[model samples]
Target chain A: MMHRIDAEALAYSYTSGQRVLDDVSTHVATGEVTGIIGPNGAGKSTLLQLLCGLLSPESGNVLLNKSPLEQYTDRERARLVAYMPQSVSPAFSLTVREVVALGRFPHLGPFGSLGTPDHEIVQDCLGQTETSHLATRDFLSLSGGERQRVLLASVLAQEPQLLLLDEPTSSLDLPHEAAFFRQLRTLSGRGLGIVVVTHDINMAAQFCDRLVLLGKDHRLVNQGGPSEVLQADILTDAYGSPLLVGEHPQTGGPFVTAPVGGI
Target chain B: MTLGNTRFLLLLGLVSCAVIFTCSIFIGTETLDLGQAWRELRSLTPLSEAPTLSILLMQRIPRTLAAFLAGGGLAVAGCAFQALLRNPLATPYTLGVASAGALGAWVAFLLADVTAAIPLLALLTSKQVMAFLFAGLDVFLVYLLAARRIHTSPAVLLLAGVTLGMLANAGIMFSRYLARPDRLVNMDRWLMGGVDVLGYQPVLLLAVGVIPCAAVLLLQAARYDQFAFGTTLAAGRGVNIGRLQTTTFFVGSLITAVIVSEVGPIGFVGLIIPHGVRLLTGPSHRLLMPLSIVAGGAFLCACDIVARRILPGETPIGIITTMVGGPVFLYLLVRRRFSDWNV
Candidate 1:
């Protein structure tokens, strides 16, 4: 399989002269769900932005399919990668279907007149994300979890080869969070590469094909299978607190817990 | 069912516009009966003794047409400004474009009167040039003041526009102070925004200026809709945000300039029509824009008719619209509190 994402010595700094990503380099394998977990301000979102080509890195380069990301045109980049931001406010009170149809913009001209195939693809995306029932509903009227699902449907409507999601389940309840991760797994199984940034380490341990831990200094500290990398010491060190790490009896995957201090 | 409801509303608006337009043509300073109006309209040859035909063709036709154009143009311009600034309260007057246009017309009027007396600058007898200069200068000031930062915040832009508008209003008041007592009445009538005094020349000029600008605004409806979906989403959808913003502002300001030049700052049409249409059409510019044009046209025509017949002589249509729009706007605010759709 082809390598979906290749980063080498990536570095980024905000205007505040604070570094968010420091010489970070990692590869995302095709058809795998790579989970990025870190404390707040660890540059997880910034790194995802750089990888998705939404923001150019201050140094180093990101390559997709062994080609420099800058080499692809805007439309080509959109067809190849879809980025779902962490927080967004819907400015217009559009229906869920209308918002999802915007994913076809790269394939459309300035007017965005959708063709027959575009309609079919949008319907398919809504179906995949289980948002078909909410297609005609007003987007602003939906609950937070429902809005997240609609946004995911919009991203899927692009039919992108690689998907980047930042805190996709941040607002979702436990059951919806599990269902969303399952949908991500199904997408990965279909040969689509996925990179998801999450605060939920336990969820990452359960579903992620590989877990990449980021330290507070915005550097990659560990990268391996969940069972190998999610040890109690590493979890405590990354979180800067006392924590417990155990195995799920049923799935045989790592499960992390924060324990009382001096444990 | 929703699509059917939308079509029905659009059809109703169109029919109302037609009826109002016809009534505006028939009822004026000198009323023309339907038979006389029809005969005058059907006649190809000019009747030497037909005073009614002459009056209809010369006075009412131009005034009615001006009302239609000004109403529709201002409403569309207002809708564009509201969408571009992302504020519900934005209008040509509030944004300073109308004030600027009024300044331009005032300068033209003063220059025309002065040039008529001075034989030296007789070559500059054309008042149209002065009007154009005033509008151009006003829009330039608005753009410069509101565009300091690369990231155009709608609130800041609107604040700048309003500040400039107040400055222009001050300039107009200064001009009024300088004017002789006799010209004050004429200036008052112009400021009140009556349709009675306009001729076909200014009406044709307004049509020339506004139609192309409105067409450009209509074509950008989808881009505006994406913009309404927020700046980042618009960019993600492949829109060049800077370019879209510049184009929308330019076109919107151009239409506002033209309407202000002809009608002298009719209020409330721009502020109310777009929001009202959004409530009916669900905030999509695809439907809101066309509906705004139709509803604006009808609303203004109806206002003008009421202005003519409400008393013996014609009152300014602005008075009628403001009086009506204020209560309706309040009612809408109350209704919005109960409704789920807050656009």
Candidate 2:
């Protein structure tokens, strides 16, 4: 199958002169979990935004299945890709089910009245995210992990072909993070193209099909399999102080950890 | 409450409000029994013998109906504005729409005869045209102040609205200053707001306008649900954010403007009723919109009743609403501090 996303020389900047993403280009294959890793302010989120068509590029364009992203209407683009932000705090206290059902907006008409299909999709998404019990709970009242799950459920309800998650597990504990990634793995296995932006190199190495390393100048320094991308020099260069990379004994995936540099 | 229980309670509240409305007609200064009131209502008895029935049917009934319609319209408008702006503090008054409408009404009141003589070009040629122009101008000002380089923030929108309201109030004071001393009473009474001054014609007009608009708003409830997630998410989910915002604001402002034109500027019925309904029925606009309308009707009817019988003559309904709504709102704020409600 052709790649879901093909970007060529994509660049973006917040202001007129300051470039946040500089001449970055990459491709995301079908059914692959592509992880984007970079230090803080490395423009990972900006790149994700560019890919999702949330921000138009200053230089190049992103192609969704060969067609330019800009050519698609907002609804059509939404049906093709689901982009989840790093953290979303709702201004009002919507119930978990109400929030999840919002994903059906694209499918509904101008009024967005839900039919049986919308309700079914909402139910499926809630069950898939293990938030069926929390459906009636207030979204604002949920813990960070639970909120993440509910938000994920909302995105899943969109049922998009490409899933873009910006730091999905940023607020989760180790166990929850592992479980979350496990769910992502299951999703990718179902032939959904997933692109997750994260700073957790070890988690990326374990779950991702490929890793795209980003640098401060909004450039892609390397892109390859986890074994090639998670090298000690690459880690140190990317993070400024990363120490070690080793293979996990059970999974045989690369495990990266930062050592205390000089006391 | 369970969803079923909430629906049940809402229905019960509606029935109770209707019953209270009927009872309100019977218990005035000159008390009439329900039978006499019914006979007068049926036109079987002369109104002169039953003064209370006459008052209830002719004066208080129309006033109460007007109060109900205006209150419901304002409250539902507030709910739409609050959701559209994503600010809890957003209301028709806070957004300057009420003040704009007041300015429009004031202009109409001041230049009752001159409106027909003014040419289109000359109409735009003076500061007196400011009041007539302020209604549309205030909306533009709100849009300009709220919008930043990227998009509008709800907090900024709220602040902009407050600023516009203050400016309109200043204009009101200036208009009052220019008027003769004899005219001050009319200005003061209109500024204070009352449903009693309205008759069946305006009430009928309000009913004609509000019922259809309310239905349209109710139909768009699901869009509001999508919007509650955030603008980006809503947009990403295929909601035309700009279109939705424009439609909601236009409809909401129209409802508010009509009500303000008919009555004076009633306060807080919009702000309090919607929030109160949201507290009972969760924040689903599907439920919130309809419930706000019903609750608003009940609340305003109750308030109008209190305004009428609380003293010798009827006090302004606006005073009663604020007097009751302010304390209730404060109580909710205080209770939220100790409770699990996160809104």
Candidate 2 ranges with C-alpha deviation above 4 Å: A1-3, A15-17, A92-95, A109-120, A133-137, A231-263, B1-3, B20-62, B107-115, B119-163, B197-201, B204-216, B333-343
Residue lDDT tens for model 2, A175-225: 999999999999999888999999888899999999999976678878999
lDDT of 2 at B84: 75
What 10-residue stretch in candidate 1 chain A is worst by lDDT?
A: A85-94
lDDT of 1 by residue, A1-263 (tens): 45588888899998788889998898886699999998888899888888877778999999988899889876688877888877666655678998898788778775557789999999999998889999999888898888888998887887888888999999899999998999999999999889999999989998898988888878888888888889988876776767788778888778887776667
DockQ value for model 1:
0.31
Give one digit per residue, the lDDT tens place, for model 1 in B286-341. Answer: 78888898888778888888888766578887777778766765665456431322
Query: What's the C-alpha lDDT at position B314 in model 2?
Result: 69
Model 1 lDDT, full chain set? 0.78
Q: Model 2, B189-299: lDDT tens per residue? A: 877788774348878878976888788778778778776766767766766678887787767777877787777778888888888777778777877888888788878
User: Model 1 off-target regions past 4 Å?
Assistant: A1-19, A22-30, A56-76, A114-116, A210-213, A219-246, B1-3, B33-50, B94-97, B100-168, B179-182, B332-343
Clashes of 1: 0
User: DockQ (Cα-based) per candidate?
Assistant: 0.31, 0.42
